[model samples]
Target: DEEGQPVAAHIPGLPEGAAITEGEVNIDLIPTHKLIWDFRIGDLRKLGWIIQCDRKSAEWVRDRYGEEAYKKLSGKFGGTRTDGETEFEVNILDSLNSVLYEGVGDKQRVVTPTMRSNDDVQLDADKMIDYYEYWHKPTKSNPTGTFGIMLADQIMEYTPYPIDSYPHGELPYIPANPISVQGSTMGGVVRISQARPIQREINRLNSQIDENCDVMGNAIIMVQRGAKVRHSTLDNGAGNLLEYDGKGEFRP
Candidate 1:
């Protein structure tokens, strides 16, 4: 039922659907308890200690050591220490505050580079799906498809064809006749024209490449800007050249 749907009456020790009443019922008296623990650690050192304590039993060490000693201990627990640990603290706090205050009321949320990359990959996926539909147009039920060969061409634009080498690997090409054998269930017949295994693989690989590029590029940009790795994920929200926004949701 939807949020505003009328409440139904439930009888105790009676069979299901025996007596049902339909109308709005007050549910304000429903017992609800929410438990929220304040786990906000403001300082970087404190944050690191919280993370360390969460993973291992280090209460004794934490209690015995001072702030500086605890930070050293925390570093020892990890395999490596960050060089710009001091600057990282300031950046992380600023980033945290920015995220918390984002998209409040009239304020517009600025997309991060990392977010842009994710959107690009999603757009690529959607385009591939469109291409698949185009290739496999005109099924028994629909009889006519909206998509055409143009979509296939667009998909190829993003997917680079590998150059042939001395030890030549099989050269890949988009199938001219992608769909065949309709209404036949016995054999592995393509339901749609563009539903070929090779095409699907190509689309998958293209998506992976786009995602990797976005992530790697965003990470480099974040490091260059002297932001902490913790806040680097925010880079995804940066502006993207590609106009792909997956389902129109700005995900990080």
Candidate 2:
């Protein structure tokens, strides 16, 4: 048996938690290595890929802290929770919240929350030019806000980047990105289709406030008649005319 030879063996006992039927043999198993390889490294990669906790991050945590901290870091990110078991990737949402929201647990405040209101979503689109400029800060397109560029480069890289392994949080798209729209002015090209009702309501409220102000204005004024007029009827309302604004001028 020690001599090199092709010896048939029952499926190398299926790896832990494998779904193969018991008593299976590698010889009898369907050949799927090729298909599996394709799935792992093929067109389907667009759907997503694996995100691993990097050695740099692990080493940084460990060196700054200790084995205890390293263990926690690894355990959470892809390290051993137990003696020989470690996770290899961290949660996407938690990572995003920590970086983008400054560690705010309140999901509503998330820069890219799972659920965004029409106004919030529109705001992102409205700031496309600013986003592009900021990310490419100090450039012709963006003459300020280096932080945006720094953050996108550091944490929010997409597609080939590890964050692309995630399928959610589509808000991180910014200026100079493929999704961004080029314009003479600012604003992204995100087409919002459901904000009309809200806009109408806002306009209605403003109109009502304007109307109320008009009524209040009319109510504050008293009709005037010259005091020199023999038949002046306004003197009867002098007390009413005295009602004026802080400048002592008749408000009406």
Candidate 3:
């Protein structure tokens, strides 16, 4: 010992003038408890120190270290994702506008959303089932189908040749063709006879047929089902979208 301080006399390859001295870290004795390193929970868990801390350790860390420091320390033990690729974040002390709030409401409710992607999210036609009657019009490049089931509540991420406009609310082309093995199952085609006056012709008829229900007045129902071409001249002067169902009942 040199003046009650130990010294290394013969270190291998010691420099000629370099003196052996204690570093600032060497001045203090080794710590009894392991050091809780900053921003590293993986290291602490390896040594098995953490147990149930019911705000006891948190209060100690927060009161002395301040809110920012507490947040960092809390994150270290917040746990990891199921995929093990990301760390899960949580806030027990929920606050908004610096006001601490603990009540649970709609924000905490679990929400399930219907998913739809544009033609971009390619769905396999071979994998499609028959229950919902999904169809994707076959194209040369996409040889299979492109359509999927879309409920009223759901909207697609991208419209795949969709006929719906944002404002018009009519998606005329939904990358799908509603079809079955039997074509035009509802009814057969018909052509008006030219033997009558132009006004009395079925295809070119144009007149009002309105009366009270008590009289049961006759009504000429214009039907549009299947691939009926909507020609500018073939309108027959009828209502735009309002049509009749398979049973000839007026449908909105």
Report the lDDT tens digits of candidate 2 across residue range 179-220.
334553222222221244678899999899777656555322
Off by over 4 Å in 3: 1-134, 155-252
> Residue 132: error of model 1 in Å?
35
Best by TM-score: 2
Model number with the top lDDT? 2
Give the alpha carbon lDDT tens digit for every residue of 93-179 in model 3: 111223433447724422333223243343222111111112222233433323343211221122232212111111112122232
TM-score of each: 0.13, 0.16, 0.13
lDDT of 1 by residue, 124-184 (tens): 2122111111211222333231222222122212221221110111111111322335665
Indicate the worst ten consecutive residues by lDDT in candidate 1. 28-37
Q: Indicate the residue-level lDDT of 204 in model 3.
A: 43
Best-to-worst TM-score order: 2, 1, 3
Pairs that clash in candidate 3? 136-146, 136-147, 163-172, 163-173, 164-170, 164-171
Which stretches of model 1 miss by more than 4 angstroms? 1-183, 187-233, 236-252
For candidate 1, give the lDDT of residue 41. Answer: 31
| lDDT, candidate 1, at 12 | 39
lDDT of 1 at 226: 28
The CA root-mean-square deviation of candidate 1, after full C-alpha superposition on the true structure, stands at 34.2
